[model samples]
Target: MTMRSILKSWVERYFSDEEALILLVVLVAGFAAIIWFGRMLAPFFTALVLAFLLQGVVSALTRRRVPHLLAVIMVFLAFVSVLLTLAFILMPLIWNQLVGLVQETPRMFASGQGWLDQLQERFPNIVTPDQMQSWIGVAGREISQLGQRALTLSLTSLGNVMSLIIYLVLVPILVFFMLKDREALVGFTLSLLPQKRTLLTRIWHEMDRQIANYIRGKSIEIVIVGTVAYITFAFFGLPYTALLAVLVGFSVLVPYIGAAVATIPVAAVAGFHFGISEQFVYVLVAYGVLQALDGNVLAPVLFSETNNIHPVSIIVAVLFFGGIWGFWGVFFAIPLATLLKALVYAWPRGLEGRQTSQVPPLKQD
Candidate 1:
């Protein structure tokens, strides 16, 4: 067969079914919208995700004989309460620690330079003088600029308050309506599809089930990990407890990469403060134990159904999606990858194959 015939054969195998064609179009359109209008749609998307997560709580409440409207109100109120607490209480705390961290950078750099000098003297070949000078220069420049950047941010923060206010007002309203009218919204969306949507339905159901579990499990994991991290850091008299804990908590989002990346600052803070003492060792050990428990115990317990994607695939998905969408992309990387996984496994080649599988064989005549 010719090259064109081979290409055509591949297309015929993958894209022959009408439902698959429609799904392809939909995926293309959705991706285009995210790339083109993602900023404009961000608030809506944020609210949609918030509503989706809170829907589980609302559902459980309703299942326990709570009225639907009341359940929504209760959950929304709780959500708003948590949001407000984070905005008012946690933000200020993190901001204060952040400023302190930036302000302390120079002192930390000086201490780090001392350590580098010792390391270079101890391991002359491995930690050469040239490398030491280059690293010291880089650290010095960064430390010098850190306070300037923080000051600039403080000066410009007022300009962002209005946009922040708009989001604060808009997101809750959107979340409320999305939760309250979820069924109506879903029905309207479903009405847009063609009558014969067996393939789409199957894919939606599978993704819906998995995504819910993922969101719930991740939320719980973050809370447990962050809380545990904060307590551990506090016990060790570690500075930036809230900031470090928050990082450690959200590190669960990207599997291996997040935890590894977060360790740098944690170790930096511990080492700078404790100066290679037993306290530093303890802090490191505590963090390692926290990570081990989360990986070995908590994650497995929370996410009962495995995503069945490989560790390599998960890391690749984190990089790819994180490059595209930044933080939210990283946050949703697993779900998006799982969606792709679902599409690959659930997609039908052609109606003939689908019918053959679903329909009973005709009686032999």
Candidate 2:
């Protein structure tokens, strides 16, 4: 019951076995490596993730009697085709729409300024005209600064173009080899671990299967939601449909935060296009419905296996991991959180079995 005794008990309860200590050291080392060299090895990590993502498809193909190398070729070619389509076709269109959106943004702000000015006059007690004008001035300044920053980035993109080209060339080659030699790679990795690794194996299997499902489900959700958004926007004749739809699609990456952030641009575009009209209301309604269905229905269907996480835990994971790894962190937040939960819940040193053995039998009397 003493503090020293309690401390000894706690350590024994968790780290009584060498395996537990080994697992702890491994986790710490992996995390340290990422923090130290994540950026330098980003392409390697990215390719690893892509290969893992596409491995399921490759396996399916091979299972159907397709040769392993041939299956790799088929999947790799399909992946390259999509990449080319996005880079050459979809990207240019989205870029143009994005440029147009940026160009029109000033006019949208002006219109919003006028509306707010009127609202100020009509509701003097709630909002004074001076306060409204100040707010608009602040917004206009922010818009101007944003445009300047974007212009600066475009001008500097030339310097980064070589790095981009390297990524384009290197990632695919890496992914192909990874797919072609997955078994060898996995074997090499496993050979590094000690023979008695049941806990490690359990954790790997749990993380691997769930992470794949989570990632694939998310990718499908993005495509489905984005396509639907594009259609809805186009049907209503909304401008920047591709750009907006893409934003809406990528928004699913960040859970609650992404959805809310995406709504701002969609609503702004809708308001600027329809100007306090019924069509504007309808567009907002449609967007809301889409988000509702995505959260309540489509996501459930695609990601049923990975939905054990709580909303609050998700947001915290997004914030925490996002701070550490930015976009990729946000993208993998749920999976990482799940991994952490698995680690915490896993019993080390046969502790669960030991606890069960220690339990007394229930009396029938």
Q: Rate the local accuracy (lDDT) of all candidates.
A: 0.90, 0.90
Candidate 2 lDDT tens digits, 196-257? 77677788888988899998999999999999999999999998999999999999999888
Worst 10 residues of 2 by lDDT: 347-356
Per-candidate Cα RMSD to the true structure, in Å, reads 1.7, 2.8
Give TM per candidate: 0.95, 0.94
lDDT of 1 by residue, 165-204 (tens): 8889999999999999999999999898898888888888
TM for candidate 1 is 0.95
Q: In model 1, where do residues sit more than 4 Å from their true spots?
A: 145-147, 349-353, 358-360
Top-TM-score candidate index: 1
- lDDT of residue 183 for candidate 2: 92
Clash pairs (backbone) in predicted model 2: none
